[model samples]
Target: MNERRTAVPPLIVTQDNSFFFEGAAAGRLLIQRCADCGTLRHPPGPTCPQCRSFEWDTVESSRRGTLHSWTISHHPQDPAFEYPLAVGLLDLEEGTRLVADIAGVPHDELHIGMPLEVGFAEHAHGAVLPQLRAPGASRTEEGES
Candidate 1:
């Protein structure tokens, strides 16, 4: 048995963002919302910067967003990742921005306002990661790479 195993990136779960990971495993994109002021925050924190409120709750995101910004990495920071990786900040319709790896789109085709959707990338170590994918980016032209 010479099965090759790929390494999965580690996920740091804390009390603040545990719900985000749990939602990822369940194929949902969750965001932290301030219960008091109804303000939404990403990279979940204990206090809302807007309202400075400790009271918070979770909300399932629409999983749809526009590419706010992006950078294509020709260099792989880790051996587990591939080169020329595309990363983008998704501006969710919920009025929050999410930074995640963008997939299923060619490097040259990426635009600042391009639409993307959330998807879960299953890891070999049983971790599910949230990633972005092009909504309708299939090649229909003949001989298109």
Candidate 2:
């Protein structure tokens, strides 16, 4: 039998944000920091909002964070993701917030201020990306239990 697979979206990697994707592929979490004023930012950009400096560097995050907010997405289902998907906004210990998919935790168990850790896994399209999981939880590359 011939089996078909869903096409997963690809990440838009640019010079300004390549490090973040590279870090995820390497199982490391990196955050962008403004070299001039020591300000950190996410969704990597070309200039620091605080200092307006073009120079920047990366810091390795602890991957430890607290769930600041979250949501369950079930509408307009996409083949790339599972239904009732748990996504969250996390406040990393490094002081920057990141949005990532939550795995291995039941939605009812998720709460604001709950501790979480970032994990890397292969998403659709064979892209490695960050995922939020309970501290010490182990997940396969496919992000299954």
Candidate 3:
């Protein structure tokens, strides 16, 4: 009999931006929201700059957004990444813009304002990185290849 081994999942840690990791593992996309004025924030800060409110809350994002900007890298910045990878800024429905890799779509098909959803990619080192893709797109067995 042959035995197959399953790799352990990545460990996500959060020293300051614990909300981001906490939400990811739970399959919920979360961003920082101001408790005082209800403004959404990215990069998860300790305070709301607009309202000067120290009180903040973590809210589940729509997991849906539009492509704000994008770039294709022919040269790999990190050796682990394959050539011709696309990275982009996704503007979430919650009003926060997130920067992550735009995957599972051809670069020629990318356009600003195209609706997208969140996806997760597990690295060789076992770290899970957030990725963006076209709406209704799936990483496996569906959508544009």
lDDT values, one for every candidate: 0.81, 0.89, 0.76
Task: Give stretches of model 3 more than 4 Å off.
Answer: 1-15, 123-125, 139-145
Best by TM-score: 2
Question: Candidate 1 vs. truth: CA RMSD?
Answer: 5.4
Better of 1 and 2 by TM-score: 2
* Model 2: per-residue Cα lDDT at residue 120: 81
lDDT, candidate 3, 82-115, per-residue tens: 5688999998887889998887788899999999
Off by over 4 Å in 2: 1-8, 138-145
Worst 10 residues of 2 by lDDT: 1-10
TM per candidate comes to 0.83, 0.89, 0.79
Q: Compared with the true structure, what per-residue lDDT tens digits does model 1 show for residues 11-125?
A: 7789998899899988789999999999999889999999899999999998899999999988535554566889899999998998878877889999999899887775545
Ranking by lDDT: 2, 1, 3
| C-alpha RMSD of each candidate structure in angstroms | 5.4, 3.5, 5.7
Model 3 has a clash total of 0
lDDT of 3 at 77: 51
- List candidate 1 stretches off by more than 4 Å: 1-9, 123-126, 136-145
